[model samples]
Target: MSTLQSQSKIEEANKELVRSFTRTVFVDHRPDRAVEFFDPKGKWHGGNFGTVEGAQNIAGLLTAVVGGLPDIRATEQDIIVKDDTVVVRLVVEGTHKGNLLGFPATNRRVRWDAIDMYKIKNGKIMDDWASEDGVKILADIGAYTPPWMKSGN
Candidate 1:
């Protein structure tokens, strides 16, 4: 295939991969497919410390955390694709219906803006870095109590 054609195909695959990740992660809450998009031993950086290796590890971690949110949605705001990577900027909206990160459900609406960069290898994702504005969501849900909020000396 010509260089231009190859680039186009890569771009399309990157976009689809990003979309699939969004669907599985935020919409369907299915984590079994994470390795299908990530390297089996890939290391994820930015805003998180967990190292996920293999699809089973990724699936188990996600499944454990996903049950907290009964309603969740992610909307892609923009996507930029290069020769071997795709960057997706999105906003996630959800309502807490169960405990998460030790915080009980407050039944409040929350939103977070995030950007994820996925590196593709052989038309499959190899690794990813994600940055998210999680503090905003915590503040929106009244779960983040600032020291300034405390009264009395």
Candidate 2:
């Protein structure tokens, strides 16, 4: 096969890996699959949680998220694959079923959105950056009050 063909195959495999990572981590909540998706020294970033590295840490985090949102589901909006990068847009929904961020379950339904970009190397996800609408989620669940709104109270 030509070099172009080989590159195409690699890109396709990377895209599939990103998709499986999303489904496993956010949809199916498979801890083992989370480990399979990320490289041993993989790095991931989310707001406030700081940087998490290594497959075992990522797997533990995914497992904790599954516990926090037992019915959470990610509705994929778009996917773009180019070179070693794959970006996915998703709308997430779930019920407040367990403790999260030091708050007890409010039993409310919450909808949030996030975009995740993964950097693939040798078919393993090497790095990821995820941006999620955390403030909206916190406000929706009554866990947070906007600064401006707090001044009015």
lDDT of 2 by residue, 1-153 (tens): 999998899889998998888887778867667878899999889866678899999887777766777788998999998999999999998888887656678888889989999999988999989898888778867999789668657
lDDT per residue for candidate 1 within 1-153, as digits (tens), equals 998998898789888987998898788877666666666666565464445665567666656556566677889999999888889999988887777656788888878898989887775667777786767766767788566655662
All candidates: TM-score: 0.82, 0.90
Q: After best superposition, candidate 1 residue 105: deviation in angstroms?
A: 1.7
Q: Where does candidate 1 stray beyond 4 Å?
A: 48-53, 146-153
Flag clash pairs in model 1: none
Highest lDDT among the candidates is held by which one? 2
lDDT of 1 at 30: 70
Candidate 2 ranges with C-alpha deviation above 4 Å: 147-153
Each model's lDDT comes to 0.74, 0.85
